[model samples]
Target: MEITFKANKNINQEQLLKLYNDVEWYAYTNDMPQLQQALLQSLDVISAWDQEVLVGLIRVVGDGLTIVYVQDILVLNAYQNRGIASQLMEQMMTKYTHVRQKVLLTEEAPDVRHFYEKNDFESCDKGSLVAFAKFG
Candidate 1:
């Protein structure tokens, strides 16, 4: 499949919902309006498309100079293992090459950890730093 990537593209609610639901991300799919608004307000968003279908996406939120937080990176189930996520990440990294800190928090899964590590992101515990978060 010839996948195309777009930055800060105009995405409708139906497209977002379908992509999120394809990956079983119920939390986002459960609140369509909030998810749509969040994407709209994010600092940057890179999306992968197969023709007109939204197959993958990566979203970042931060000041763009000192730090950038990778808030989300996901590809549809069928689209996984095909380098779509990596391409999306590469675009984000290339866009913020000058940023000192690029951070992301994700579930403690082996594949997830491997993906980030392969993309040159070291875990907080592996370095001389630590991370903390409190979800409401």
Candidate 2:
């Protein structure tokens, strides 16, 4: 499949919701408005499209100075192993390469760690700082 990349924020809410739900990310789907607003206000967004379909996306949040957090990265299940996700990460890393602190929080699954490590990310447990989060 020939996938195209978009570095814009003109996505529709339904597309976003569907992608999130496809990955079983119910936290974002639970509050649709908040998800929409968060996407709207993100520092950067990169999306992959197959024709006009929203096939993959990665979003970041940052102050443009010191820190940037990867808020999301997802691709449709059927579209996996197509290099679409690698493209998204390449663009995001290139965009934030000069930033002092880059971070992302995710599940500790082996595949997830492998993906991030392949992209030059190290787990906090292996680094000097420990990661902490308080979720309701």
For residues 24-115, what per-residue lDDT tens digits would candidate 2 score against the true structure?
Answer: 89999999889888888999999999898899999999896799999899998989877788899999989888998999998876479888
- The lowest-lDDT stretch of 10 consecutive residues in candidate 2 is 106-115
Off by over 4 Å in 1: none
Which regions of candidate 2 fall more than 4 Å away from where they truly are?
A: none
Give the whole-model CA lDDT for all candidates, comma-separated. 0.92, 0.89
Clashing pairs in 2: none
TM-score (C-alpha) between model 2 and the true structure: 0.93
Please give, for residues 41-100, the per-residue lDDT of candidate 1 as tens digits.
Answer: 999999999999899999999999999999989999888999999999999999999999
